[model samples]
Target chain A: MIGVELRKLFRRPRTWATIAVLNALPVLVAVLLQLTDLAPRPGEGPPFLSAVLTNGALFPLAALAIVLPLFLPIAVAVVAGDAVAGEAQAGTLRYLLVRPAGRTRLLVAKLLAVVAFVLVTVLVVAAVGYVVGATLFEAQPTGGTSVSGTSLSQEELAGRSLLAIGYVTVSMLGVAAFGLFFSTLTDSPLAAALGALAVLVTSSLLFTLDAASPIAPYLPTRYWLAFVDLFRDPVLWRDVVRGLALQGVYVGVLLAAAWANFTTKDVTS
Target chain B: MSAVIRTTGLVKRYGRLRAVDGIDLDVRAGDVYGFLGANGSGKTTTVRMLLGLVLPTAGEVELLGERMPRAGRRVLPRVGALVEGPAHHGHLSGRANLSLIDAAGPGGSGRTRRARIEEVLDQVGLGGIDRRPVRAYSLGMRQRLGLAAALLRRPELLVLDEPTNGLDPQGITEIRELLLELNRRGTTVFLSSHLLAEVEQLCTRVGVLDRGRLVLQDELVRLTAPTGATVVSTPEAGRVRAVLDGRVLGVDGDRVVVRGADPAEVNARLVAAGVPVSALALQRPTLEEVVLAAAGTSADRVEAPR
Candidate 1:
């Protein structure tokens, strides 16, 4: 079932289009940064955007930081939202259920497929950012030093980049699970996608307000940028752990609710 | 013969509306059982329950001697079905859709899967167009593809709901012949339809449903057997109508339909009166009339068969 689901996910042209569009953003940013020849001062944008101006290796981290808050999550939302509702809207749910795919198994397959989509999307963006950044920027300055003024080995840079990608993947799981829950509740893929986006937007809105301080830490979007802490000299673990724990709660609760509601659904479509 | 499908006092309710009232069915192996009903008469609902797609509010369903839902996983592989209509991804080719469904089932090697997919496509007359996107196919072609998917596993029992709903006359004939051929190969077929003529011609046995209840069920031969009225056709119909007196049920052009009269006696009476009957025949009610009478919507005022 997982094999079949993955095959379906990859076969659609829309899937590739979404990936291409996402990767294009980082390429555009690299070009603009090269043409301007003006590096952002500290704290102007995401944690690594300023650093990428001198050292091209850091651009993958910068691209992830720029997209993680909105673009990546939205891309994950679209795929996850369509996971179940798309089948229902196409009137194929009845045929699938009649095959006795077993509601639980089908739901699990869809969730895994969404997770796979998230991983692929994030990696493609990072890879594109790396190539564009390398082409446009210098690997080492004339003084033979990076912005941090410390020479890092190739192995360490590779390891940290992978960790950054892993963290981003985990953070997006909450949105994926939320999208899937909405997918089970409705037959329209567009409605499901919008519904999941509404929840994320509301969470982000609350996170920005001082009045929402009491509930801010629990919001799904609160610690999304914690991946930045990975590139810090000592690697801060405080908010990173919190982010993982909070995402765990979201994934657990939302997936449980999705399964409970979907198992007993009438499947009239 | 062993029963292929048996339902005991099955019921399903959506809030206060009882979609399927308590109904018992016995579909024996090797018989083509036509489940007949009007548009909203609960035929689709019952088919859903039997396939474990919808849980019944009350009662039990047994398929191939095993309880449903609990045994759905164990039993579904042996059963192939096309519920409501052909539901598939519009963007996928006909071959791709079948391959996906076949892969979702329990066990099949890649070689076997490919061979079976090709074989069923050929059987359904979709040989060369297997690679075409399903969205480009016509409604009749989709119906054929649906049938092809159902046959991919060479299932022991085949269930189809209104398989010929939107088909033209030629397409309908093609489906009827395919179903008959499959049945001849020892597949037990259970189908639902509102078309009385289709069922009368294709099914050996039938169960008629009306407004969430089973009104009548019997062998097709017994149900359509001559049981009421004798029709007498003659050029002198105006004269024959007078002799038959109150026995005449109604006058239909040149034919005088009479009730409770033997064909020989009616012939003698008409000839003796110099009516010169050209044709004297017993009137066997058609399946359509039987269904309408059972549904209590008959306009011709035919007597209900006991």
Candidate 2:
């Protein structure tokens, strides 16, 4: 069933089209910055944007920062939200259920497929950023300076970059979980996607308000950018750890809800 | 013969509305069972329950000797079905859709998947179909594609609901022949439709539903058996009625209904009396008449609250 789902997910042109369109923004940012040497001031405008001007190797992290705020999550939400609801809308859910795919097993396969989409999308964005950075800017063979004002070794930089990518992927999964949970609740893919986005938008909105600060740490998007701390001199594990735990909780809880609802609900469509 | 599909008092209720009232459905092996009902009479709901797509509110469903919605994994692979209408991903080709559905479950072996798809496509008269996506296919083509998906595994029993929905006259005839041929090779069929003519022509046994209730179920032959009368068509209908005076039930435009189950006896009597008989046959109820008599008015009709 997992194999079948992966085939269905990757075989469609829409999946790849989404990945391509997602990379376009980061690539566009790279081109604009390449044409004009002006970079955003330090500590402002996408976490690592100012740093990517000097160290082309840092562009991958810069690209992650650029899209992580909106594009990536929206893409994940749409795909994950469409998982069950899209099938229902297409009238294929009944056929799949009658195929006896086993409700629990189908849900797990769909979640994995969504995770795979996130992983691939993140990788492609990072890869395009790397190529764009290398071609447009000077190489920092000696290793780029960390945000903490320390010069990191080449291997150390690569290791930390990979960690940041993994972190971002996990955070996006938090969005996917919300979408998947909503997917099981409604038969409209648009509604499910919007529902998932609503959660993220609400979390993001609440994170900025002083009144919401009391409960800020518990928000799903709160630790989304915690990966930036990976570039610290000694590495700041504080919010990073919290973000991972928070996403884990969301994924677990939302997935459980999706399963409980899907396995028992009647497939009238 | 063993029963292929047996439901004992199967019931499904959506709140206060009993979509599928308590009803027993018995479909034996090698039977072309036609399930007849009006729109909103819960035919689709019952089909869903049988396949475990919709759970029964009360009672039970068993397919191939195993309890349903429970033993579905063990049993559904052997039962092919097309519920409501055909549904497929519009973006993909018919073949792609078939492979995906075939791969979704256990029993469809990946190695033989292509061959199975090809065979079923041929069986459903789409063997020469091109690589065009299903979105471009006409309604008839889509219905055939749906049938091809159902037949991919060569299931032992087929449960098709309104299988001929969008087909032209020729397409309908072709599908009827295909279904009959499949049944000839020992495949049991449970066909649900509101087309009484289709059911009358193909069914060995029939069940009728009216407003969520199973109003009638019996062998098609039994349901349409001779009504202890004979019909005679003649230009001299008046002379025949005069001869069979007391036995004449009714007369309508050169056709006379006489109180005799034996057509041969009626013919002999008419010939002996010098009343030329153009046609003489024992009266048997048509499936439409039988269904109309057994079931109530259309369930789609809404009445004002008393």
Candidate 3:
């Protein structure tokens, strides 16, 4: 049932448009970073482009962090946000619910669709960044030594890229879960989408503030960039674990709330 | 026949407003029961409670012989519904929408599922719209599609709220006849609507609600013929008055007699007396009048089950 929902999400024009536009953004950013004086000289350390790309897994990981608040979150929101509210607005929810299918099943299917959309959005960003960054910056990927005093083979680059995509994908699940959470609360898709984005943006801002807060670990957004640490020589699994734990908590709470609200909703509106 | 759906002391309160206020109901098996009320009259709210979408503040709902809010999962399978509006995935074609829904149930071979889809589409007069995207369908067509989806499971109990909404007269007639046929096949229907005449024509039993409370409930015939019309007519007004003076019937001009009696006898007597009666027509009270009268008179209000 959820796979069917995922297919519906992919077929939507807005979903494709969001992916296309976001994919082009990183390419443009990479080009701009290379033209500036801030970029590294031939022998200098990794520049801003390299900071994003050559940090091996950190390149796409950084790209995800940049896109999540403005691009990825909204994309997830559009998909998840429309779950119930969009159905109600389109005058199709009542028809769907009338089936022998339980409301809980419908809610789960919609949430899972949103999660799939989020993963797809992250992969699009990572793939686009890899192609554009590798072509424009010509920097050898960091970590292992270079062969022939240059960058590694194509297979090595592909392996590193896939790992980066994986990190970005898992990290964005929080955004998708939150989007689904907001979807159950509103009858308007636009409202649910924008409302969920607002929450993501606010939490990201609070998480990055330079305050000496003891509660940072509890903020789900704090782990948004934790994927960057995964590319280290000795992979720092602590932040990755913390990020996964934080995401699990968000998913658990949001999904539970959605189930409770939707199952009991009057929905006459 | 035993009631297939019953509600005792059902109350649903949203903040300070009581959407469904202590309404009791009994719908027997195979009944084409009409639920009548104006907008915001709590008809939809009551149905939602029965469907287990909204919890009742205080009540017991028994559907298909099991108590609701507790045995909802057990009872819901035998029941099907189209609560208020037509809801479907706009991106998917109509056939795909139906197929997706059918897949969620006990898995079946593709051929059987497609056949089931075709059956409902044909039943609801939507056989030609199987391939069109649901977004392209007009409101009436979408309503028919919604009905088709409800019938896909071959549910024993069909609960539809305003099933005729957005439908043209012809479409309404078609749905009404289809419902009648379904009832004949032993499928109980619980339909909600503000159209009283349609209810009068299609429903055997009805429950009239007003402002979140049930004002009347009974077999349609009982409400329509509470007391038949009584017409008394005579060519000479003075003679008619003299004959009916202090009689136990309503007197209007040259006519007088007990209400609900046939007018033929009154007209025959006038003609025999060389009175040359101009006209005598019986006026039967309608369901609208009964509903209106019931809504107005507190004495006629029936208490809901507790």
C-alpha positional error of residue A149 in candidate 3 after TM-score superposition, expressed in Å: 13
Worst 10 residues of 3 chain A by lDDT: A143-152
Cα deviation at B262, candidate 1, in Å, is 5.3
The CAPRI quality class of candidate 3 comes to acceptable
Residue-level lDDT of model 3, residues A151-251, one tens digit each, is 44546545655765676666667777777777788879889888878877777777767682576778767876655454444556798788888888888
Tens-digit per-residue lDDT, A1-269, candidate 1 = 99989999999989999999887777787788899977788778766778777888788888888788888888899999999999999988877777868899999999999999999988998898888778888765322222344655676677878988999999999999999999999999999999989999999999989999999999999999988777666778899999999999999999999999999878777
Cα lDDT, model 3, residue B213 = 92
Q: Backbone collision count in every prediction?
A: 0, 0, 10
True contacts kept of each: 0.66, 0.74, 0.44
Q: What is the lDDT of residue B208 in candidate 1?
A: 90
Docking class of 1: medium
Q: What is the interface RMSD of candidate 1, in Å?
A: 1.1
Error of 1 at A133 (Å): 1.2
Worst 10-residue lDDT window, candidate 2 chain B:
B236-245
Best by lDDT: 2
lDDT of 2 by residue, A1-269 (tens): 99989998998899999999999999899899988988999988999899888989999999999999999999999999999999999999999988878999999999999999999999999999999999998879999898999999999999999999999999999999999999999999999999999999999999999999999989999999999999999999999999999999999999999999999999988
* iRMS values for every prediction: 1.1, 0.7, 2.8
